[model samples]
Target: MDTDAILALLDGQYLLILGAVLLIIALVAIIKLRGSVHQLGQEHDQLTRRLDTLWHDLDAMHQDDTPSLSGKSKAPTTSATPDTSPELLLAERRLFEGLWPVAWALHDKVGGFLRAVESGDPHSESRLAARNAALEMRSQINRSRPFFDAEIEGILTQLVDIEIKAHLTACQYLDQRQSNLGVSSEGSDVRESYRNKWRQLYDREANELINHLVSAMRKRLVRHVP
Candidate 1:
């Protein structure tokens, strides 16, 4: 071959090698981009799952249909609080579980007390029932004494106020009905005045009960984050 022919052949080979290098570089770049995209997808999916979990927890807390303490095999604690961290859940769970049983006992005691007032029997049955309820409340407060810090104490105080109001309202209504049954000619005016007073007292107590229950529940609310 002549020099010109050999030079042309060498030039064509060089061009082919350059083209091959460019193709390889392109493939490597494409592979690296794909890897990055896959990593981003994984990260996005994890974030989505976490967000969904947080939403579910909030919904559960709002729904108020969670299992009762008795039905719950484990502690009835949850990460349902709003804007809470993961570490907070464990800490809160410990605190909440410790307080729950005592709270429930107090609740039941208050309920029983209210029912006794409603039973409308002013005899020994009523007095005994009231005494037992009061004893139960005292017992619960003593048992939960250790866990009752400022926050928990405040909550319990609110709850007690609610119970007292509800009991007084029901009792007032019962008392009014009982007193209105027997009236004499001379005492008719006094009985009527008493009935009116009881009615007013009942209304006031009912309102206070509702307000206190709402306030107590609101104050106990916690925030959680997923």
Candidate 2:
């Protein structure tokens, strides 16, 4: 072949090689981009699922209105044909009225924390509020006991257990939050372990408390049945 023809052939080969390299680079970039998109979709799915679970739990709490702790629906009447003494009826009313706010406060605080967990609020303010509310609830229950009958007092005592659980759960949550922050050279696995532990603890205690509040049913507190 002529020298000019050989040079032209070499240039063509070089162009082919350069095109192949560019094609390979483009394919690699596309593969990496696809992997990142897939990862993001998975993360989105997880977040949606977490939110759905949180809503389901919270909705369940809102659906139930009846209290569970009452021995029976037997509040004294106020008619001329009195079922119980005026003072006794007043005491029962007081117990019911006092407990109304406590149940709501528990629900609100518990719901707050669960939402916080879903939202990834590391400070966990909802759990902290729940802790303080629970302590205050115990105090209120104690202070109001003097006016309540012995049977009523027993029902209120169950709430004390729930309150203590709330307090302890709050402490665990605070610890977990700080530990997860990694100011102390914590590893990813260790932080993840603590996070999972705190989430499970909060869910269990919070759900338990919600169920227990059914014991403080409004119907039992008031006299609606003839």
Candidate 3:
């Protein structure tokens, strides 16, 4: 071939090679883009599931806290009737009457303390009062342990346990919050979420236990009526 034709042929081959390189680059870019899109979709789905679980938890808490039309929160009621003598029934009723006030007071004080801590306004006085109320309730329960049936004793123990757990969780969250004050970090955010989750869980559990205790007490007292 002549030099001019040979040079033209070489240039055409170079252009074909350059086009092929560009096509490969475009394919690689397209694959990477699809991979990124898929990863983002998976992340979005995980976030959505977390949010749904959080919403369900909050809704359950709200339902537990709300009172029914009769000005009392709905709770499961026991239907069993007492089969004891009149004197025993009277004694049981009297004991329960004496214990109910302290039980309710303990619930109120612990609940108040938890609310204050969760709202970022933890008060030493409220915590102290709650501790005192718990002590008093414990003293009463111990003193009256002989008179309580197994079911009532179990409910009382659960109530105390729930109170202690709720109180401890609140204290831990408060301590964590104080330690992380003015320090904004990803680790702190994760810790905060963890503490909040535990606090809410304990609070919900406390409310449920109190409801169950109230139901048991009512069932016992209702047998005394008529």
Highest-lDDT candidate: 3
Cα-based lDDT for every prediction:
0.49, 0.56, 0.69
Kindly report which residue stretches of model 1 are placed more than 4 angstroms away from their true locations once superposed. Answer: 1-127, 161-222
Alpha-carbon error at 205 in model 1, in Å? 5.7
Better of 2 and 3 by TM-score: 3
Per-residue alpha-carbon lDDT of model 1 for 169-225, expressed as tens digits?
A: 444445445564535554555445544543343344333433443444344444342
Highest TM-score: which candidate? 3
List, residue by residue over 1-226, the lDDT tens digit for candidate 2.
Answer: 9999999999999999999999999999999999999999999999899757644543333232223433222322222323455666676777677776785686567657655654667545676576556556666766776665444444445444433433444444455555645455454445556455545544555455455444534434544455
Q: How many residue pairs clash (N, CA or C atoms closer than 3 angstroms) in each of the candidate models, in the order given? A: 8, 5, 0
User: What does the lDDT read for residue 23 in candidate 3?
Assistant: 100
Candidate 1 residue 60 Cα shift, in angstroms, is 40
User: What TM value does model 2 have?
Assistant: 0.44
